[model samples]
Target: MRLPLLLAAVGTAAIASIAPLSANPEVELAAEDMLAPYYAKLERELDLPVAPAGAGLAEDTVLTRIGVGSCNHQSRSQHMWAKIAAADPQLFLFIGDNNYGDNGWEGDAALGSLRAAYAKQAETPELATFRKAVPMMAAWDDHDYGFNDAGASFTPRRWSETLFETFWGSTEEVRSRPGIYDSRIVGEEGRRTQIILLDTRFFRSDLEAMPYSETRPPLGPYVPSTDPDKTMLGEQQWKWLEAELAKPANFRIVASSIQVLTDAHDYEAWENLPLERAKLYRLLAGREESGLVLLSGDRHAGGIYTDTPDETGGEQLWELTSSSLNLAFNNTASNTAREPDPKRLTDFISEENFGLVDIDWAGRTFTMTLRGNQGEERVSRTVSW
Candidate 1:
C-alpha cells in the first residue's frame, strides 16, 4: 500500500554528549502495536517458522529472479515487501535510501536515530518475513547516510557505516574496510552472475549546486561539475572496481544508489560528476562482452534507460531504475521540468513500485518488470544478449 510522504526533514542541531536510548520508546511501542495484525497474518500465511538471523540462500546460488528497489521510510507500512516476496526473487537489492533517518545531530543522538530507523525496519513483519524468504544486499544513499544529499564531508558517515554493517550483518572484514563498496559472484562457471555494489557517498566530492532559478524543479539545484579533480568512487575503490570488472563472469550487474545514465536531469546523479560518468561508460564499454547491465535507485520513480552505440562506442548499455518501495513521488506534472531522455524505454512511474529482473540463463535473455502495490506489472521489457 502507498504511504504518506515521509521524507526526513534536514535538521541542523548538534548532538549532546550524553548517550540516548537506541530508539524512541513511544515510537517503538506504537510500531509493535501497528505490526501485530500484520505479523499475525504473516504467521497464518507461512507455515514455516521464522528463520534464524542471517539465515538465507547461499552466496554462489544460481539466481533466476532478482528484486530491486529503494527509498523506503522505516515508519511507513511496508506492504510492498509482501508483494515483492510473492514475486519469489532469489535475491533482493536495496540500492539506497533504505531508511529515512535524516537527523543532522552528531554523537549519541545521531547513533540513536540510526539505530531507531534500523530497529523499525527489522521489526516490520512484512520485511522480517521477506528476509526469511530471500537473501538481500544493500548500499546507502543520502537519507540513510544521516543527511540529505550528503557526500564525503558528512561527518557522521563512519557511525552510519558501522550501524549499516551491524544491521545488515556485514562481515568483520568488510566492516574494517574503508567504504561499503563490494562485489560478489553467484552461480558456477558458465552461468555465473557478478554483482558489484558501489559506495557513492563515502568518498564523493561535493556536488555543484545550481543557482536558484524558476526553471529547475524535478532536477533540483545540482549542476555538472567541470572540475577534472572531482571523483565519485575515490582512488582505491576505482582500482578495486577495475580489478573486479576484470574478473570472469557470464553476466554482471553494477548496482548504484543514483542514476548513472540519465545525464539530462539536474537531479543528484552520476551526471553531476561528468568525468566519472564517462569513466564508467568507458569501463563497461571496454568490457562489453561481459554482459553488463546497470541497476539504480534514488529518483523515487521507476523507469528504464539505455545508452546507444553513439554513447558507448557501439556497445549498448541498459539501466533499470526502481525506487520508492513504500513512498512514491506521485506528482507527474512537476517531473516534466527535467529534460526528456530519448533512451528511456518507458514513461516514468510515480506510484509505489519495485523492480524485477528475470534471467533465462540457457536462453541468454532477461526481462525487467516494474510492479505496483497490487502486484500488477506496470511496465516490462525483455531483451536478449
Candidate 2:
C-alpha cells in the first residue's frame, strides 16, 4: 500500500541537538507524539510494498524511466529533490549508504539511528514529492549496514539486513527468502524487462584497512588482488544472479551501490574486489541476454560506460552510474572523461552529479542524462544497445 506524504521527521539524535528538551519542552513533546505513532506503524508494517510474482508488463509495454544515485547526505539538501522529479522518472533506485548511520553498534541505539537517519530523508520535501509520484527501491552500503567499510561479519549485519528490507518495503514472501536480493519485471510489446536489484553489502567481506604511514589519501588508488575467492557479490547472491539472468527477459538492469567498473574514485568500489569484478564481466560477456545495462550509484557523480565487443564473439555491456542527488563533492580534478587506465579496468568517469535514465522500448533506444542541482546537464548520452 502507498503511504501518505509525510513531513520530514527530525532524526532522534539530530532532534536532541535541534530541539533540546531543556530549551523547548513543549515543542519537543509535540514532535515526539507525532513521530512516535508513525515510527511504530512503520516497524509493524515493514513488509508493505510486495509486488506479486508473475506481476509485470504484458503486451503494449509502457515507457519506463529510472533515476539512480547514491551517497546522498539527506541532512544537507533534503529539499532539493525537485530537480530529479522534473525529469519524471518512474523509478528511483537508492543504491546504498543512503543514511550515514554508524554500523559499529546494534540494539536500540543503532536501530534508532537507522530509523532517524531514514526519517530525515523520508521527511524531505524533495524526496516526499517524488515518492508520492514514483516508486522507489533501495539497497544498503557500509553506513546504513552499520560500519564504514564493514562486511558481512559485522555484528549488526543481520539486524541491519532486516531493517533494510523493512525500510525499502519488501513483501512477506521476499522477506522469507534467504537474502534481500530479488528481481522484478516490466513488460511491453511482448518483451519483458527484468530489473535485478542485488544485495552487495548484505554479505561482503571486510575491506582491508590502509597503512597509517602512507601519506596518500585515506581511501585508495591501491590495487586489489585478483584472487578467485575475493568477491563483491557473495556466493549465494552470485549464484542467484546467474539463475535470474538466465531467465528470459528482453532487458536487465543490475543495481549496485558500489562502482561496478573500476574508476579513479579514491573511495570504495568493485575494484576493491577485483576477482569478482572480472567474474561479473565475464558472466555478462558470455550471457545471451538481449539488452543488459548496469545501474549504479555511490561516486557522487553520474557517468555512462559502454563496452564495444572485441574480435571474440563475446557481448558487451554498458553501465550508467549516478550519485548524490542532493549533495555532491566538487571534483577539484578535471571531471571530463579520461583515457581508460591500463592498471585498473575503469573505462570512463565523471564525478559530482545525479542521473536520469529514460528507456523507450518502442524506439529501441535508451537515454540517460546527468544533471547538477542547478539543472545543468553535466553529461548526456544515448545508446541503441
The lowest-lDDT stretch of 10 consecutive residues in candidate 1 is 1-10
**TM-score of each predicted structure versus truth:** 0.83, 0.75
lDDT of 2 by residue, 2-27 (tens): 11112245443222221112223244
Which number leads on TM-score? Answer: 1
Q: What is the lDDT of candidate 2?
A: 0.61
**CA lDDT of each candidate?**
0.76, 0.61
Local error of candidate 1 at 100, Å?
0.4
Residue 104 lDDT (model 2): 23
Model 1 per-residue lDDT tens digits across residues 261-317: 886677789989988988887777776366777899998887888876454788777
What lDDT is obtained when candidate 1 is compared to the true structure?
0.76
Going through the candidates in the order shown, the clash numbers are 0, 7
